[model samples]
Target: MPQTIQGFSRLNKEEKIDWLTSNFLSDSQNATSILKQYWNSDAKLQQLHDEFIENTVTNYYLPLGIAPNFVINNKTFAIPMTIEESSVVAAASKAAKFWMSRGGFKAEILGTQKIGQVHFTYTGDAQKLSSFFELTKSILLNDLKTLTASMEKRGGGITSIELINKNDQLANYFQLHVTFETLDAMGANFINSCLEQLAESWQREYNNYPVFSENNAEMVVIMSILSNYVPQCVVRAEVCCAVSELTEADGIDPEVFATKFVQAVRIAEVEPYRAVTHNKGIMNGIDAVVLATGNDFRAVEAGAHAYAARNGSYSSLTHATIENGIFRFWIEIPLALGTVGGLTKLHPLVKLNLEILGNPSAPQLMEIIAVAGLAQNFGALKSLTTTGIQKGHMKMHLMNMLNQLDATDTEKSKAIHFFKSNKVTHSAVDSFIKNLRQN
Candidate 1:
């Protein structure tokens, strides 16, 4: 039974933890200790973390790792990834090295447009509204000149605005569909601000417009917000190599692997079940880098998934081709990242990660993220088509299993050496540890 408390946010950090643990946790003291244990030792740093969100109890930490040897567009980079999952960093590094010898990855931004909308209800004639919109569109744009001055100076601002009629879908529904270009920033704040201002200006005009007044109808402004599903903010990254170069020492044929990999991608393209996991693998890489760089992974994820389902059915974000002794694998995804906003300036680690990548611009970051996704997908598909996913994944997971079982360093060393030639499983490792301890 949970008790609701008023002004929970007003409580201090320790007080908040006390209430949460007392109500929810069985071992309140232990949980409180664990939460406090992760807090930063430095007072300033701890305060920074606390102010990031409401109801702050303590910090939650994830491993910040580096996957080196990535060469995108002929430039080498060691990308930082913050994730709790095992084997993702390993797979990305392996795939990057594989492509490095094959001319590296080629990537480019396809588009950089973001959108926001103002929804409202009008019970008047659609034709009259259209005429009114046409007449006042310039006035509405002019009203925002002051608001958009700084953005326009920075080479980004409102690009277009359209009056959309949705009365057929819902009675008296309409929208102001606005597009923008906000270079070097995610622009959520900027987009929403412009939408709100536009809504304010548009409503004032609506009140004065005689057409709706003559019909004794009123236009009610609803809400204004920036959309995360930016289908227009897309980047493409790919790797290509001579078929002969894709050789494995285990005697798997390159052509056979390529064919199987392509088929696997094809299965994901048509099957929703497979597409979800297939895309998840890609996102494992994309989201890691996005988070490491201090951008919004949730927004990137939403946009990417919506873009994949743009054809009315969910499909793969990656594609493959084999022709003329050449094999090419690629991914195209919507990644609206920012290098100049949000946590980019606040988080210390984010600053270091950006420096590690040579301080790439927003579009450049998009290219890198897309390449990461493609590399991850390639690594996964290759493993799935050849040696099986568990062989490598479980091997990487052995350390975690050892930690869970509380094995000593000697036992862990023995287990690592033993599992090199043997398949890794929970029971086998448990038994190995038990037997080694007995002997």
Candidate 2:
């Protein structure tokens, strides 16, 4: 039975913690001590972290790791990844190293157009709204000039704005569909600002239209916001090599591997059940990189999934093909990333990750992230088609299992050695450790 407190956000960190612990926890002092223990040693830096979001709380940390040896466009890079999941960084690193000798990855930006919308309900004739939109479009642009000035100087601004009718889907529904080029920034704030301005200007200017008086139908503005479905803001990353060069050190035939890889991608393309898991593996890599670089992974995930199902069925984001004795594996994904705004400039690790990446522009970051996804998918597919996925994955997960079981260092080392040749299952490890303690 926690009670609400007014001005909770205005409270200091210790006061906020005191309120939370007193209301929610059985031991207020212990909980407060626990929260303070996670605070940064530097008071100024800790204050910065405290102000990053709403009410201040102790920081929740994830491993900030680098997957080394990513060779893209003939330049080598050690990509940074921030995630809690085991084996993701390892898998990506392995894939990068594997493709490095085969001329590495090649990436290209396909497009860089972000989207936003102004939704409204117009009870009047659709044709009239369209005509009114055409007439008032310039005014919308003029109203956005102050907002778009800085973005325009950086070579990014509103690309297009169109009035779209959705009467069949939702009665009296319409949208001011807008597109933009945000350049090196994700531009959600910028895009939403412009859309809100357009909405405000349109509502004011519509009163003067002849149709407004004739029809007596008002245009009621609903909301103005940026869309996460940025299909046009896409990039492609691929690795191509001779089928003979695609062989593993384990003596697996190159042609056999290529055939299985291509078939695996085809199955994902045709089967929705498999496609979800398949695309998730790809996101394992994409999300890690996106998170590391301080971009919106949720937005990237939503847009990528939407693009995957663009053809009426959810399919694989990564594709593999064999043509003219060459094996090609690639992925094309829409990523609205920013290198200069949001957490990119705020979060300490994000700044380091970007610096580690040689400070790529938005398009360049898109290429890197897309390559990471493609590399990740390749690692997963290669494992699935050969050694089986759980073999390596469970091996990587053994330490976590050991920690959960509260094994001592000696026990953990022994378990690691034992599981190296034995199966890694909860029961098996539990039995092994129990027997070891008994002995």
Best by TM-score: 1
- TM-score, cand. 1: 0.98
lDDT of 2: 0.91
Where does model 1 exceed 4 Å of error? none
Q: Using lDDT as the measure, which candidate wins?
A: 1
Q: State in Å the error of residue 7, model 2.
A: 3.6
Error of 2 at 404 (Å): 1.0
Q: Once superposed on the true structure, which residue ranges of model 2 sit more than 4 Å away at CA?
A: 26-30
- What lDDT is reached at residue 124 by model 1? 82
Compared with the true structure, what per-residue lDDT tens digits does model 1 show for residues 1-439? 9899999999999999999999999999999999999999999999998988888889889999999999999999999999999999999999988888889999999999999999999988889999999999999999999879999999999999999999989999999999999999999998998999999999999899887888988799999999998888889999998888898623789888888888999999999999999999999999999999999999999999999999999999999989998988888898888999799999999999999999999999999999999999988998999888999999999999999999999999999999999999999999999999999
Q: Write the per-residue lDDT of candidate 2 for residues 193-293, one digit (tens) a residue.
A: 88888989999988877768887988899999999998899999999999999877346888898898899999998999999999999999999999999
Question: Roughly what TM-score does model 2 have, to 2 decimal places?
Answer: 0.97
lDDT, residue 203, candidate 1: 98
- lDDT of the candidates, in the order given: 0.93, 0.91
